[model samples]
Target: MNRTWKNRGIVFTLALLFVTVEGFAQGNNNPPPKSPEVHGDQRVTFRIQAPNADSVKLSSSDIPGSMFSRHMAKNKEGVWELTSDVLAPGAYRYRFEVNGISVIDPRNTSFSESNENIWSLVTVPGNPMMDTRDVPHGAVAEVTYHSESLDRFRRMHVYTPPGYESGEGQYPVFYLLHGAYDSDDAWSTVGRAGFILDNLIAEGKAKPMIVVMPDGHTGPFGYGDELPMDEFIQDFKNDIKPYVESHYRVKANRENRAMAGLSMGGAHTLGIAIPNLDEYAYIGVFSSGVFGLVNNDGSVVEASETAYVKQNSEVLSNDDLKEGLELFWFATGKEDFLLDITRATVTMFEDYDFDVVYEETEGAHTWLVWRDYLIEFTPKLFK
Candidate 1:
């Protein structure tokens, strides 16, 4: 009798578990899709509730604007819904386009990134692409002053190399630029530039130097038809250089100073730094368009992009640059939309009897690739 009772109890427990599982499954026919959870201060999400609209498009930096077709069953109150997987954390600017007009997220109260007034801001946790491993991180200080040139308040972010104040030696400086629709924080905040430089300086790969990140999108100086080429030069000479010399203990000379940038920033650096050979000895351009091949007059000298590259192929021929300027480095991912442009720019440099360091990696136009480029490029500068 005791053995029979034990057997009955075991069977009854098993039956209860089976019923419970079946009931749970039946209750949830289609499981709810999980939203992105925070991962080590990383991950990002964008949501909009447009119940009446037929289609809504969401656009953000780096990622293309994606379209979402709303479904009544998936979204509450018959609203449109869309979500992104875990995204590398940092400040992101995005906008929603209902039909054709651009609008900020009605639900989100975050501030807009710029005055042009299209996209709003979203801050994520980790900036993995621009991660600086706590070697010797620097603080970001905003210095504001009246500018006689612009006749307005001018601000610049000055990055003092590790132990700048305690150390007696003056350091070299690199003026890093940001692309269009970006600001000075793009380097320190999102790019993790201070972290990268600190690590490089600690490892003895890069010489300790003050890095100046200036706002590159300042409109024409002194008004009256500002040329991109001329404005590019004026920014370095008038705005950026004077500020560094006055405030920081920087080596205000040509050999120790360097200039580099990406995309629009790259174009700005090349245009400004190349011809003014006396100002910057080391120069780098990452995934910049072939705007340099054109003349100062803004006219295309080379008949075709193909011919232009062929003409300047020697300077940017290989990963190991031949060296004409103190250091000429340019890199781009194979999948980058501007790969052809980088290749062409390299070719143009080579054809023009200039030597350049050219390299290609794997990725599209993104911060991930740009971050790695910093790692690789940092070691080469001031070497």
Candidate 2:
């Protein structure tokens, strides 16, 4: 009788569990359909439950442009789905366009700040350089400093390499700037600056260093015709440099300093670093050259409104200053829209008898190229 009762009890418990699971499955606790499902073959299928929407489209930074927008087909269940072509292994920023209205994927929790806007971030996870691994990891701290130049408190993301908290030595500093439409935080996140550095440092490919990512955009909003060049340079000189030197264990000299940027930030790198060439040992410009300096017709070269090229003529012609510059590197994608400007700028440097290492690589103006450039660039620094 006891055995029979025990058996009955076990059956009862399972029955109760079945009812509970059935209720839970049918209840509001059931999560919505997961979108952006990455498959083993590298293609990604996106899904959205838009019962009322007539049409849907998927657009991404990885998708080239609007010409490649993927159509999402709706089903009987009011759900829409689209599977993308096989993608390269990297992170991508994507969004859903429902009947011409732009919207982020409601299911995705991660987002990245881009050239002009924000997009949901998704990764396929194959590249080890940008992927998180078990290593002596560094920390990226969102730093707030008083920018007396801007008359407001500005923010920056500073990365201190592994063992920095306990180490007693000063490390070389690299000031990495972001392009337009992005702020300081964009480097650490969308650009994957911290992770790439971490991997390089761990692999013994790069020296452990403190990377200072500062805000290139100083305006109240987005980039306007005001050209944040002047004020940003002022902030870096008067506020950023002083604050960083005082607070961090930085090797405060020209030999220990480096600066590099992409696109608009590349223009910034040119404007700021070239004028003050004595202060930086290494400079890298990616996917950009001087913006206002060049024109479509390639006729006149005013050179960035301040007559920058003419004003800095002394430094441009000084061979001693060129000797001090360890690396004046420029890289642009072959298909990059700014390819002409990059080549012209390199030619400009060479014309001044300045040494320049220019690398024209495959691909276009995308974050993947920038990250790849960083992976290859940082390994050459501080040696």
Candidate 3:
């Protein structure tokens, strides 16, 4: 009787152990492991549990040394994983292509939508310039106003510095602009201009000021058509400026007003701000494909005796105009496709003997370079 009872107990214990092991195996097959594990040195590891997938590829945007499509290795547990090299500090968008179909990271919820493509977003921390530190953040408001130029109610994003509401002092204004095919929120969302300014102000690196980002697109037009530069300039000057100055406690004068932009908006800055030097004390042209100076083939168009060039030359030649100008800044990436044009523009400024601050850094025509430009440019403004 005792031997039979001991045999039964042994059988029961073995059965319980088997059930636990089976449950663990089922759980392992149920869901994938944590993905996008950002490490201390900025290296990121991505994982996905695709037991039946034939192939997996990882695609990313703006990650240095990243391949167009990196093959992921699958483990015995059917878990596919790939570790990326140490990346710079910035927000990056990525996606996994499982058997030719793109999908977002199931484990990561952060995402960004551009056109129709949705990409998983990951931000490697440690960039103080772009990071949102424990500081007094400014208020970003979506303002809607009737555009007399477009004959519609357009929206803009305005960033009022911390203490702006309580402070009685009028602050200087920076008329920030976005590239083509982007809305006014581009500066706040993608460019992160608000956080950049917050950290700069908190650390005493930049003066507390208001930033106005306006949409550059005017009228119902598709891509490839010439942007209505004249309409945009007039609306900015006649309509947007008045609305901003009236709504916010801003110093509405040339000495306190500054304008800067990137890409197509940079071209607009060069066209609008440089010619209207008396209206803007500070002008920043970043990665601007200077209209006549840059050709369609990315070659430098020689300084011609065209009316446009001649007009800019005349405006920059005046000592009084140059002296009145607080800051005439131009910056571009060394590897930018528009580098030749930027260099030519600088040469034209030099030829005119204008006091221009030209900056060149190692990067392509991307938001990473533009963020750096904003950090360096803001400190030099309204000083």
Candidate 4:
């Protein structure tokens, strides 16, 4: 926090800028290539500086075709380049495999979290729902708050709708959660929660509301391990909700609040919102359901499956819990890995006589589908 270090930080930044500019100043050279150039035709050309490697290939989820990995042509200057077929208008994450070692695009500053790994972001704007149109925008702020349940500091992104800063009216709060492997930044970034809400508000399709994207990741665990879901739920109930309600001009009633999440976040939403139905009137589950109860082969685990059936049976059977419920919506892609999970969840709610609206759409479990789910779900909230 000292001025000396602050000045040194500025100097370091300027040095980096100067070095990059100085490289271009050396005329007729392209060693440091400008990468991820989006063309008007929707084709994206990517260039990377990896001269020493034997082969450099592009690896991306958005890249068309099998493997999503293609070798790039190397030039005399050792810069590797590749141009892809026209891509859809949406956000895409990509990284390069330089001689088998995966690496991000050094030239791109826009990037996002992908589970345990990181990837660079590229946006090809065309869709009205996903495009950054000339509409009044909202503010996405990174907020830090202390969690008493976990005894640690946590971070979340809060999106205030347009005119919220100057308006005096208290806005209803929508608690949006991100899935496993993603940080608190996912919703605000690749999920495009803020922009989606902005466009919806601009079109008068959705009411202006405060979106609270909390960190759902609780512990350090990899795939196939049991995530600390209860910890996250407790943190949400004790820390995240209180922080937002106290800091922002939020409506304090149960009807003015909503909760939704995708994948692991959907699991969290079910865990938090259902048992505490008096708090969240609107609930949405996207591409996820009760996990750990059944194995991948469809066999139920006696320990988890039997226990959960008895655990929330009371709340599930109680008709009084649904009195103030506005909506219980669920959406999942037919090809999503969690499609079965979602189906089971919908079946369970239906069996319990809970009025559930389920929609099966096309696509898999990805940010694109989640964004679409948000667009469809938000308009139905806080009504």
Candidate whose lDDT is highest: 4
Tell me the spans in candidate 1 whose CA falls farther than 4 Å from its real position: 1-37, 40-44, 47-57, 64-82, 86-129, 165-167, 202-205, 220-227, 289-324
lDDT tens digits, residue span 221-254, model 1: 3334332445545756776688778878878887
* 261: Cα error in model 3, Å: 1.3
Q: State residue 231's C-alpha deviation in candidate 3, in Å.
A: 4.6
**Estimated TM-score per prediction?**
0.67, 0.87, 0.80, 0.89
Clashes of 4: 0
Quick one: RMSD of model 3?
A: 12.7
The alpha-carbon deviation from the true structure for residue 258 of candidate 3, after best TM-score superposition, in angstroms, is: 1.0
RMSD of 2: 11.0
Error of 4 at 226 (Å): 1.4
Ranking by TM-score: 4, 2, 3, 1
Q: Backbone collision count in every prediction?
A: 12, 0, 0, 0
What residue pairs clash in candidate 3, if any at all? none
Displacement of the residue 135 alpha carbon in candidate 2, Å: 1.6
CA displacement after TM-score superposition, residue 254 of candidate 1 (Å): 2.3
lDDT for position 302 in model 4:
49
lDDT for each residue of candidate 2 in 1-383, tens digit (9 for 90 to 100): 43323643454344334323443444424345677899999888887666566778888766554335778897765667988778777777787777776666766777775543566777776788888889889999988899998898887889999999999999999999888766786778867888889999999999999999998878645645555788999999999989999999999899999999988789889888998999999999999987655677875464434366777888888999899999989999999988888987887788788889999999898886988888888988888
